[model samples]
Target: MKRIVEFMKRNYKIILVVTALSAILWSFIPREKKEDPEKDKLILELLTMVLERGHYSPVEINDDFSKKVYHKYLENIDPTKRFFIQSDINEFSKYETSLDEMILRKDISFFNLTNSRLLQRMKESRKIYENLLSKPFDYNVKESINIDYDNLPFAKNKSDLVERWRKQLKLSTLSSLTDKQKLEEEKKKENASYEEKSFEVIEKEVRESTLKSLDEYFNFLEKELTRDDWFAIFLNSIVERFDPHTFYFSPEDKEKFDVSMSGTFQGIGARLQKKEAGVEISELISGGPAWRGKELEAGDLILKVGQGKEEPIDIAGMRLDDVVKKIKGPKGTEVRLTVKKVDGTIKVISIIRDEVETEETFAKSSVVEKDGKKYGIIYLPKFYISFENKENRDAFKDVAAEIEKLKAQNIDGLIMDLRDNGGGSLETVVKMVGLFIPEGPVVQVKAPRRNPEILPDPDKRVQYDGPLVVMINNFSASASEIFAAAIQDYKRGIVVGSKHSYGKGTVQNVIDLNQFIRSSSFGDLGALKTTIQKFYRINGGSTQREGVKSDVVFPDRFSYLDMGERDEESALPWDKIEPAKYEPLQINYDNIILNSNKRIATNTTFKLIDENAKWIFERKDEKVISLNLNDFNNELAVADEKLKKFKAISDYKNTYEFKSLPDELALFEKDTVLKQKRERWHEEMQKDIYIEETLNIISDIKLLTKGKSLTQKLSLN
Candidate 1:
């Protein structure tokens, strides 16, 4: 390790030179200038607008604040510039006396300082501005000029009110707080008469409220800090000197982001979030302590967690990070959580800490009957199984086991629901696809300047070769797309659901910024999420800007929402590559389409969805106002009426009453849906309107095959 370190140190200069050259070359590359000057201008305008008109009370602006904000913007754009260095600082020092005047005089040329040195000075100016704004100010003061309170309405409570006030105060007090201080002192004295309380009571109240208020304030601060306006400014300062992805993370944010990306942390295996009322159980990770205990459920709000009943710590208004720290401990330690169930009942659940196994994220299936026909319904919440922990129980294995159980029931068709599945392990997806396809490449991954690697099916044998229908929605992404793409490419199954999946085609590689930073300067900073690779379908089309368009689209309200990859800033452009070669499975889709038309025409659910979509569109942009008490009540009545109409249309099947096949009669069921699918895989491959259409196509093929067999026997006679 020492030798390797020595070698890296010795070759560090070479690496830096190579990196610098690459950066220079990439910067100059004559690619299509996708840079939107309008967007850049809009960003600048937005920043200016936000600073000018934002909720900051007693809004004020000064040359110092303007310069700092401007510097922040520049830094966000480019962080690695030498303008942050001492030499550049010294250069800016020469212009220090005239800098404010230059800014006030609107001297555009003043900004034309050399890129490296100017960036450094801008960074310094940004810090100065931040420090100036950080000083306390009177948020309640109303500015005569530039009064904007657009976001003030969104403040729902006292805490939100305070946040709005703080935003205004920060803007107004920018470098001019002496007057504000005087006003605050005067206001305090004026209020002192009405607010007469004993000093002891006041102190006690202050001390008691401090923690809760601080927690609320920090929560608000976190949201404010993460806002695009603030983040852009923050990043602009640092990124100007480093890579675009490099970022500073507060300790709290760093931990949360890490847990989000990794999906596992050293905890009791329960996901919790701080809600308006209290800390709530977001999810009980399977095989985790909470999950193994089988006492907690999603939506169970946590009131407290402690070693014993008496020592319970009230977690109300606590930051999620802090709550997590309290709950998580070394494996085998006991932690008890007092929880309120969704039904209004409260209970205490004790769980022992252990490594959480995220294998059961995907739901297993069993055969159920609808109109006396046995069907396999596999409920997949998210296409997740840990690739990092492949040895033990996982999604693929569990799903396979469920499929086998369904097969034992001799089911005719399969419904693989991908709705709300945000996607997970690419490896599990490949293996899951392999269960359907007979040993072939499932998906292709392409990296920069490298040939695409094909992830082939892991299994050689097919399992339960039946009519397969993949259910998807707008939430489906990444691994979900991979599975859908492969199934579609092979003509293996029909895709069903929303207009398209979430277009998250590119992958992110997390870089621990703390590791790269000089330890002496900043300690334990956060990580940077950098775009590393893009995933493409085996058929060459990317699930990038354009997500996977389903074969059979379903109506969803979110269809109108601008959600997915294209909406994200700095998202990589989408393009196609040469398609991978594979043997195409011939399917008779003509009949399937014909059948789909008939089913869709008759399906009450589809009709209601269409009507709902139309209604939604009609009122999409309608501004609702309810000033009077009667108007508010009437509006609510109208909303409830609409909901009632929807509920009336919904034909909710009794899921619990749905029966599974008995074990005794399973094997001899030759005419079952599963048997027919295996017999007619080729014929059904074409008509995948939904998996049911595929099944219908298979049934037709079976009839055709049976007819041909009879004809052959008659000919022999």
Candidate 2:
């Protein structure tokens, strides 16, 4: 078995593995560190063997690859262009095209030299920043700093490096000046007798804060990290060239990955590790914003975080907990993560924040009444399923129960709010879609080098055949796209939201690397996840890149961004085969849709929505920003003023009213937290323009059907 597995590992190229495996046998041999180069070489050889044989699409390691890896690894380490000067680049340039050769020979000379230089530069830069912050800056100077670094060249000498640090420090103080000015103004507004600190004192405090952040950053570097951590970043940089999703997880990274996956939906969904160089992403939660965005991945280093439209605050050497605090914010808000990719390019990605929900707060439904007609709304956060037991806490079952309760209320319409529900269990999605249509093929799965298999809804019973609207946005992905595409293909419901859902249609399998090596006793080999299958809609069209399109599209905040599966460079391309033989629903609401579009075109909410989308789009693409305080403040004020016109957007109201079902209401009375969550949900739903519009359409459907329930009307067929 061991010999056969070795042969397979040496040649096999399309192995599918899961994210975590418990098949790890006991081995006390401690994992290798870079201190012992021979043992580290063994781990590398094992990893290379696995990648060469198991990755879906592995590239040959040639001089071309070596050059790519060299540049990418270097860029990943020094993304800010501050630490390494032109001469440093020249010295390292020789190895830029020789890195792949070194990998084959298991040479560590390049890493040894670069790591040493980076440490030296870090120490040098620390002294420069401390010295500059030691003295007060003359704020009266009209000097400006260029905020964008994309077009700039590396500093040619030490003096230039010092200038770079000076501008960065000045930018920090400029922000502090604005904040202090605000604090003083607010104090005076609150009370006429209030006293405020002077501008000089505020400037001193701001400089002190910056120095404190620096002190803590240096403390972490000197204490908690090592050279091996930097080398791990280098290894991952090499692997990522295969695809955005492929990565290398150091032993420490694997542990962090397990812990973070346990509470993934709570933050930006990225597991970060502190390293001798900076902070690197250990792994991203499967369905979190980082995974969905495609720009972030394991091995990529987080350079800074910019809140809202503010310039990014450097967190390269900052403490891990403090870095996390800046990333985590209230749901529906935005936090920009400035990350350095394996290739060294720096980009700021904006993610709408969210958090993990408790079981009781995960999924809920409400009833909205319109024109004396009642409609039911079921908001599924994700297609959750418990793996421990067969019948415990399944999302499909909870949704079915909600449907039954809505039917008892004699509801006129039903809406499944799947906005920002990244995706979850495939089985639950298959079962959930079954509730709306008759038993039929739901999704098609295509494994590597195999014919596509049609996964059908095995249950023949239709749970709800009424007026339906399924909501989705850019964040709706994987299984969410599966459900939305099936419903759209069946023409069973009117799909609504952004242009389309996130187009992540490929299925991934992760496996324990140790399972492949037995006698070697080389300790833990971590785990590897590989893409194994492509998912297609029932109509035979792949949802890999071109996700399911909405019937009624709206100008959502993400509409203008490069956020879909198509935007992912490594995403599988869309394709088609013979269409599956399944019948769409026998209902027609083409005119109702046209009526809704007409109303949508003229709606004030959508008008401003379009304008705001434009604003966000323009803001993101701006190539230059002034670092001068007056110029910065003036520019920000203009944007803020424009945003004021849309203040009423969140407060828009209609005559629609929402209420919980009797069972939930009774249950909520006993659980105060549950009650509060439901009340908050109801309040938000009332303010949702999309929900308001949906209620109108559903009410129109009721009028068109002459007050007959949709299920009853469908019975005539």
Candidate 3:
């Protein structure tokens, strides 16, 4: 994502040497007829080789690293400590420190042992849950369950494990039972004649529902997941030890990664969810072929999928990912689906697969009027780009187009909202930052043993020059940090929202592992995403651990909670490099920040928000919950009462009205779905206190700029 070009350009020789070595070795290795352990060994060998040679800063794969990987893998498989007992741990603990040696020798004995034991334990637990849920729980008894699974030890024996499972299940049912009771009470309040079910009847229903969900979950694990899937998990536990960003993507996962980054794929564009009956249509992407066809609808169960003129394969009891693979194909291909419609009719629906764009993934702008001035707000969900095709839609081009449209409407100021944006293509972000500034360094990336390379906006044309505000939150990461850092460094705009953005400055490149082997009987070898570079701001400060600190910080629920890159144990260290040469703009932010802070300090809504944030921070460590029905109900009542004051947070709205651009308004006549999405966005913005504050800040900046201009003219005269 960050260093694709640089990696290929600089590491061609290293890649060639490894490819030759892997080809020679793979040629001699015996191919197994039964199991795929040979492929696993090859993956381990290649991953270590590439990571050691090509990673930004690879860690020593010694005993310490081995211990971390061992525990992490176990935690991944049995996180709740319910499946594996103390005896299993004792058996697996022998390889805790020797995993490094085992990995180097291409021996997967540890993985083999753990995987088999876990499967057996999972099979046994199924019976325990079924037996426990069969009888009515004594809700009158006082008991508590702690959800801090990491701190809990493995059960000593089978009896202890069953007791642990009982408490967990009881807690879950108790929660559901209370919710159902409240729902029935509300229904009775609405209509006195409404027939309310008895407590026993509701309790039985909750148990049945829980059992169904657990059965479906176990069914998926038993049917869908293969040895390769578990091996992928083990591989990730190894690779992530190098850094949090480094990952091993299985063949199926690699495809998903590509789809996520590009936000476009060739498919019927119906979201599917796995259910006991079959794969259900969760939703249809607007403007997609399936939605346009009108034959497919949400809640329809897909029975089978077929290619053009081919025999359909029944998708009953198939994995959701597998079902999706069968339905999706290259653009302009015909795929027929045998579906059971919501109306209880079974029919075959023919759909031509086409490129479907997830509208929510792209940037959209809304124009809002505040204090008689129109300002534009552009929300970018991610810096998306179609890596396979440049001609396809990208965030940079779309944002630029939106800027032009907003300018045509004669907007006074601009706000770029990057909250909850996890970031995407690095090139897209560089071009996006170029839209605001006139030719300057956007970010400085440094690879291992290499000088920092400045990525600058070569374009001298400035798309928007007036007062600008960039909004960010704790979830805003990588490319988002790069954009915010550049904007802050240039003094070109005000950064607002959370205390700081998500600290994820490292760049990754997905290396196709199949490229290393010339030929293989072992099918697709998948890919690896490894950290290759860490980027810094134009001001020489790295956003690795210390993310871009906002010029004006807002109170949030996670304000005091540890999160982001800093919270990750394997995150790359933050460092500073020599600053790139750039001129900072002369704008007076002192008065603006002071004024905003004064307003926030006294505003009742802000005060309440700050208080709510503290309240949330206090409850962050509350992991234990009462399983007794009366006690659980009391706990929920106390929480509800405490949260009643914070309800105003959602109800709060500004006096300004938000409107869509004229172009979108015209398009809305035909695209009702897009219109509805925009309406929801605009409605949310109307109630957003942060947006209101940003608009006020923009107004202040505009007023300050005008006053300075008049002062300079008078002085010259």
Candidate 4:
């Protein structure tokens, strides 16, 4: 989920100010060193101090909290219960209730013990997997393995662990064998003379592939991760006991988070994925320096990275983040990359780093026609902003620009799609709500022992006054919820989508942990993102656990699943305050909602989606899987047979043709990559039954508005 952050303002300084910490901890400071345990201790002390003083509602650091952190840290490190055995757990269990004391005293004995033991266990696991994959499995063996890891106990001994590893590998290989056999049969059906590989040959090939994957997985663990990474996981377990959104971002992770929030970074602009061979380019951002150079292509393995005139360092086995750090630098600086192309050719490509904007993160609009009238859909991926530069491109400015473009097209209605928009800047959301309604209170923010601060749009200008719709889904969160809740409270627009948006109402502020320390000898102390406040709707309701429910609900595949902020154990409870004084827009959507629901009840695609949702809920906990080839194939055949009834859901398509706005058409001539992306989006939109129903709702609203206006004209006559 994206963070909804409130930047450091004057008032917030009072709560976070820890001026006395420097004087108190001065004697405990250590000398300058590359890696220091003393630095870790200092960070822990600083984090707890800030959390206790500045967090909106901090949980007490008692034994109960210690037990939660203990289990959570262990579960996060070894989620599948493959690395640690019962003996390791027994050894670690002794300190489960004492972690709170350790934190209080800045002692890391528990963390150090677990970290070393995990490393040892991981080393032993490599040999176990290697030995198991060296031989073939007997598919004739009739056995089943429970895939549920949470309830499964740790192995009793080393031998039991090895047996556990064997069964897991055997299950994987057996599934692959059955799939290969089926594909061979399909090839024979397509061409009777086609030569198929032997069953034993395919089995060996699958085993080799599985072995390579394991090698890469272990290689990442050994080469990429460090002690600090594990320590960050442990730190997060401590902070998250306060709430789910509170977290500790390592220096490397903090940089990444900044890039995500801004959606612009100075870099090569190519996404990389680590594989067994090396780091491979997944996609080159359109209009980026690498894309402009036209030399580096996706699937090319980056072998080395060099800055300016320095000698290139081999990155064959280096961590991906470190490799990225070497490649990305200040704008106009030269970086050379040695890459192996997909055709097995080696090339050295030098490119200048520039500010690359991720286009997908911004707002874009599409125009579609229905019932002889045009409607505009503006898709906002997040409420992003550059906290460092005010003039930089942001969600509010881009969306306002899109609205003007749609106005130029003379569209009758608008749809603001916030599906999967986790959220971003809180300030941006307040301004974005101004685009739809007149100047009014947008949302309410409350901190611990502070009066409610009512944020409003004071421009007194409405950018779009026509029929409007705000679309959301289960994944839409924080700032998205604020926008929807405001619109719903004002009765300015119809909120439509899954039951409600993601319920994340709290606000986080990332504090630079190094600011409180006077010593540069300890290096960067990373950052702490703690929840310092909770936001409420203009109508006095908070969207903490109960998110902004849609005015018109649509059945979705995830309808019955437990998700969103409500599912988080440490999520803040829902509450309310006095409502902000504001007048609701004079628009009634009762008929509009009623009409949409009537149509949804008869829609066959929606009915099938409801059935699919029910089917998914029924099998949500079907964890026991067959390890035998015959039984596995039988189970797959039965599932496939049952899933045939739902195939029409994928085949369902609408007749509406979505197209890019007038401005994007001219740019598409030089930027074919962007054109291809828009074409794919349009294709997906055409098949979206939810969008089709949304268009119908907009049509109903338009008709209602027209009728109301005509009555007013008659009265004037």
Candidate 5:
């Protein structure tokens, strides 16, 4: 550890010196002067108009304040600029006082503060003004002006007398009601006809309702003031001082996010979700310790966790983060959880936490048979690999191995499933794409004032030569986009799935918190994730706001949800540059769509999807009926009947006759589908209809190539 610290100290000083020099240079630098006075004046006029519309009082024109803000704005605009130079900065500085005056007078001509730096400065100045207005005021000693709780002027001072006066004014306003207020006051006029005694009953009901409302308001406030909330807010405040991408995560959130990103964690292997009753087991991760134990099942609500059955720790009303911390322990430790099953049975299950290896998250392959032809299917959960670790375990290498194994089995075609894969290592993605096509430009990257550079495939050889199809969905993003773009650009395979992928093109670098505070007065402030660069396709279009559009599209339940880059707050803007020149791949897959549409039109599974979507849409927000025992039983029966009908439509029995293959071929096929329902499970794995469509396309490609080969042989004969 000491050696490691020494090494970092030796290398990190260079970065510190460079950063310090840049900051010092920027602080003293004179920036460009504004050539367009009209533009500058328009910006100022706009700011004034916005202030007036918002009912914000303008700041008094102070030359010192204006000059200080203007200089700060210049520094923000071009932090690297040094020496007394540049006309734009100088010109903007010259009109600083005039801008302040225009803002103070609420001039209509001020409307052009559109630049980011200028906007930030204007916001800061407005905040200063508001802070000044929010100061406590002395309401006790009033001149002739009317001043009460409801009609008090903005305060600008803090004093003990002011607090007493404000409280006194609030009490007086309640005591002395105005004519308008009295006219609109709540009255028991309806009860006057009934009796004077009935007024007491009405008053009690109104008081109870008001009390309930207040109780709910305070409950919400209490929940909002949790330790986690305060910690999150503090972290955010610290991160906000730096770039928008830089962030801090508490230990719990950090653990969760790390688990999601890496797809590995120390747990019993059950996926949990917060349900109405308690944390319920959603699914059992295959090959996990929990799955091996077979003691826990999906839909079992965990009520308590305990050690040695000594009084269980009730987890009701506990935050998910807190619950997770309690459940996660070192490997080999046994933690018992009392669960309530859906069938109304209670059971205590002891689970041992262990390191769950997530092979499912990597590349897994299977053979699919449709219309008496076999197609290889490779499901890649994410383009993930820990590059920092010395262990060479990588996604690209694993995927390449899977492809080679499929090749050895003499598969006719291939389907690469990328559905719900929210991307990872950019280096791995480029290498993965290289497995299909000969080495060429896969992507391009550009930064401010820098020429765009092409990121080419590092390898020169193709791993698989047979027909190929790439599957994607709405959740597919970043590295996924890069892979899809490369495959599309090369025309090496059919790109099929949702209409567009999740457009997350920005790259983030995780800066250690300890490293950041090493030279500062504060020690170990926590980690910071800073956005370093952006990703672009080889075609010059960014996959930022506009993700990759598929050649064939499929429907998904989450299609209506706002889940992409455009929906994200503070996402970077999308733009393009000159297209990089490259020859497109020679493969043809136009017939894939024609065949897919025909199959989908007659498919019963797809028909159920359409019907279910319509049903959900119609009953999306229907309130539950408060029914008696008989009516409740009747409602449950109706719901069960509807579910049965939906299930029937989706259940398709296999009717294709099996042919006896050669002994070697038979063994290979048997081993692939040794488990019960293997064929059906493989079919469901191709849930994205567009991916199924792609597989069909690959089948057609194989036939077309085979036909051409036979024709050439006949011609030679």
Candidate 6:
């Protein structure tokens, strides 16, 4: 091993120089600027070759596979059934079997046919929505609309398509009508003269809004969507067939993805997805303006965006990227978003644009006292590391430093918070896991055409040997699962939280398409992230579909929700391998875990969480929502009434006073806003039932271990 290390050290520079020279030489090669339509085919050919050569679990590209890809692409394109008709489907069905030939031949016939048909249908549907909206909708009429469009069939003809638009337009206009009615009621309560507008006038105004949105959508379709634009979508359709995680990013999109992953970006810090009505806020970045403001939520639908006192421009039908462009601007600017809540309430919220520092990405420490015993909680959002800059701070180093700080604080116990930490650097995580265990195999990596390599902790020094616990949830994935699994297998710590962490054990490397194309100038060929490896625990169990099982499970709101790796249709299957050489280091986690489980069973906080989980699942199950204003309002009230019981979950607290490490307080002193944010986090810490429970478990561990050294205690077990 020493000889191998010496050889690697000696040859590293030579290898790097050779790689650099290869890249430099490749760039200098003469290339043609081709305007040929066959460029996409060439890209597809290269992508297929790469997937075949590099993919860990390459799937067959047979006729059956081609059919699945065709269906998947169609589902992705017209998921809501708003555009395509039965005849269009019939026309596209001819290539249902021929897609295999097309994929093999790189033929553009299928894409051209579908693209032309979609464009034609879009043009025709634009007129239909306008013609139907010319007349006022009858709100008094008792009619229901099922928005579960995927389960429903496409329009049979142009008349059928028109009816579809009519129902859709009414649903949207109905929301506006209800909002307007509520406004008038509030105005009346304030004794303000509310000009009574006729229902027809309100309907006309709503229709005009819809028209403006359609015009904007079509304008974007005509101008921005080039022939090359859909190629990325087409490529993505092919790559996703292998697995949901495998993806293609256009050069522009790759930059966006990089910016997003950088932990700080000058944007609203809310992930958006296009829905039927508007751009939905998929998630709010922790410590971002959106999360700090707490006005927007994950499920909130953004209808319009107003920039610095500008008239709110409707974003109901706008593309997600376009909406993102409008929402993201320079720091210190203001962006107002008109959002519709889950309960059908519409309101406009203003957010001051600023650099959203993702505190969750880096390791942060806060002291919490339980039963006269102080414990340090290391909240790790991700296994973050900057590959471009070796000097830039990484999660592993920061986490170790934090542990040192906590050690100086004389923390009786340590709890590593890995909840919602969608994994980052694998090397970082292995180093991080070493912070607890003295030395052992952290994870086993099995790559294509390579032997399984057991990644062990090089450091023999255990940072903290106190009663340790690792907290994880359904969102904890990849590297997060690796650390948790290692701890669990080694019996070095107690793993708590959800039944399992997110089962994303696969590794991906983004290959630049432009770099692969020698002497070819096809503009930007984008990047493809392909899964080339899978991770396994020291115990040999793959954390693929069946993620690392928690030592002590706790109920949460996402417990019943389909939130794990197994929930995804295309997720890789879980398997097992030969267990690595590692001995259990835990003393008596069974007793401690049993006690914790009992507490979780009877704890009021958990009971509230259990009830909340059920309520959430029930909400998710209800696909067909009422269109009637009264019924809709009544159902929302019923849901709220039932959900009221679960409000105590977040309100529940224990005797734990949380404070940031003294080193971090200096930064807060300079930034008043950050100080307030930290204060808010500290306040929330008090109410966190999960952390409180973890501290209780730690206190029990300390009591159980008694006067024995942590190493001696573990060795005895």
Tens-place lDDT per residue, model 1, 1-717, is 000000011223333433543454344333343333222332332222222221111123455444553544443333323124444445545544453444334342334463434334434433343443344333345422222221112234434434434443342223122223334557778887544444344333333332333334344434434333333333334221222222333545667665655555556776664443357675555446675565787657876667633345555434455677778877777888868664333466887787664434546454545445566767675555544456766567877887887877777667787754666666677888988877777877765555667778888788756666777776677778788888888767677777888776654444343332222222333444333456788888889868888776665554555556565443456788888777646554555546665776686755665676666666534433323333433554576577676654333332323333344136428646443322232222222224444344444433333323211112211
Could you tell me every candidate's TM-score relative to the true structure? Answer: 0.54, 0.82, 0.85, 0.85, 0.56, 0.90
lDDT of 4 by residue, 326-406 (tens): 788999999998796643335678999998867866898999999999999999977888777889889999999999999
Question: What lDDT does each candidate get?
Answer: 0.52, 0.70, 0.81, 0.82, 0.54, 0.75
TM-score of 2: 0.82
Models sorted by lDDT, best on top: 4, 3, 6, 2, 5, 1
Off by over 4 Å in 1: 1-233, 236-250, 257-360, 370-373, 517-521, 618-626, 649-651, 654-717
How many Å off is the CA of 524 in candidate 6?
1.9
Q: What tens digits encode model 2's per-residue C-alpha lDDT throughout 1-717? A: 000010111112243331111122223334443244554565565556666655655678888888878776766776667788999989999997788778778787887899899889988988999999998876666677764554567798999999988887887677657766887989999998998888788888888867876666666566656755776777777776665556666667666555543444456766675543368775555445565565676556787676776545678545454577678777777888867553333456788777644453256788878777789999887677765576777789999999999999998888998876667677778888998877789988766566777878979788997778889887677888889898888877778888888777766555556665444444555655455456788888888778778888877655676666676444556788777889775567787788889989999888888777676667665645566667878876786677678667756876667898999889976888667766766776777888888777777666666654443325222
The residue-by-residue lDDT of candidate 6 on 1-717, one tens digit each, is 000000011223333433554465475444767664667776786677667666668888887777888787776667667789898899888887777677778787788888777778778877887787777776666677887765888889878878878887777677666667667678777876766777667667777766665666666677777776666766767887787677777778778876776667897777776544457775667788888897887667887777877646665444466789889999999999889765444677999998877664467788977767788988887788777787999888999999899999988988999887778888888888888877879999887655678989989888778788899987778888998999888877789999898788788776676665465777777777777788899999999988888988889877886666786666788898899998776476778888888988998778878877776676664556666767766765676676566567646766667898888788887888767877877887777888878888889878877635564335533
Name the candidate that leads on TM-score: 6
Model 5: how far residue 252 lies from native, Å: 6.3
Q: In model 2, which range of ten residues has the least summed lDDT?
A: 1-10
CA-only RMSD, every prediction: 16.0, 7.5, 8.1, 7.7, 17.6, 4.9
Q: For residues 190-267, could you state the per-residue lDDT of candidate 3 as single tens digits?
A: 999999999999999989867875776676578878998888989988998998778888998887866645457889
Top candidate on lDDT is 4
What RMSD value applies to candidate 1? 16.0
Q: Is candidate 1 or candidate 2 better by lDDT?
A: 2
Which candidate model has the greater lDDT, 2 or 6?
6
Query: What overall lDDT, based on C-alpha atoms, would model 3 receive against the true structure?
Result: 0.81
Question: What is the Cα-based lDDT of residue 587 in candidate 1?
Answer: 57
- Model 3 spans with C-alpha error above 4 angstroms: 1-34, 261-357, 707-717
Candidate 2: which pairs clash?
Answer: 12-53, 17-509, 17-510, 18-509, 18-510, 18-511, 66-100, 265-356, 266-356
- Compared with the true structure, what per-residue lDDT tens digits does model 5 show for residues 1-717? 000000111123235533554454345322444333332232233223222221111223467545544443333322322111233344345556564564455342322331433334323433332332233322233222222212232222323224333343222222212211222333435344533334334333333433333333234334443434333432332232222344445544555655655667887876675533457775565556776675787657786666543434545444445556667777888878878654333567898888776765567677667766777778776676775574857789988988887776677888888865667777788889888877688888654345777778899788886677788776677788889988887777678876788787766554443331114222223343444457688888999878888886655443444446765433567888777887675445666667776776687776666565455455433333322323433444575576676665445434322222233245655665323223333545534355455656777777766623211112211
